[model samples]
Target: QAAERLRLSARTMHRMLRVARTIADLAGAADIATPHLSEALGYRGIALAGTRDAA
Candidate 1:
């Protein structure tokens, strides 16, 4: 996982704004926006859903 690999706490890693900024750039945006945040949140939600299903 990101925490083990990066040697950071999961909470710290999850809160990284730099990753959100990069995600926005990858989406071809000039600036980070609400859509970018929503997209990121969606991914996290999907991931959590998968984890819950497995459990």
Candidate 2:
């Protein structure tokens, strides 16, 4: 759902998941949580904001 809203590509979504996994690992979480995913997406939004493809 969030991916659809952000119009992220499959590769982008995979990157987000990797980021989320890293976040979860840093937080000592056994599994990825919503907050981790949200934070990853937030970072993605920030990264995209400076580009011509921002939406």
Candidate 3:
């Protein structure tokens, strides 16, 4: 919803680290680790949300 609300492309919005940071915070992570980054990227597209979509 943030992507559409912000009028941002799914791809572009997906790459945004801001989303990752938020996810990390929600997960109570002390730092934005690789897992957090990967999880954040998952919400971007269907192709990688389940599979693998490395940036």
Per-candidate count of clashing residue pairs (backbone under 3 Å): 0, 0, 0
State TM-scores per candidate. 0.59, 0.83, 0.50
Candidate 2 root-mean-square deviation in Å: 2.9
Q: Candidate 3: where is the Cα deviation over 4 Å? A: 1-15, 47-55
All models: lDDT? 0.69, 0.92, 0.72
* Per-residue lDDT of model 1, residues 1-55, tens digit only: 5447657566745654466677889988889787776666566668779999999
> lDDT of candidate 2 vs native?
0.92
lDDT-sorted candidate list, best first: 2, 3, 1
lDDT accuracy of residue 1 in candidate 3: 65
lDDT of 3 at 45: 61
Question: Which lDDT tens digits does candidate 3 get at residues 1-55?
Answer: 6567767686776576787888889989878887776676567666545566454
lDDT of 3: 0.72
Deviation in Å, model 1, residue 37 alpha carbon: 0.1
Better candidate by TM-score, 2 or 3 = 2
Ordered list by TM-score, greatest first: 2, 1, 3
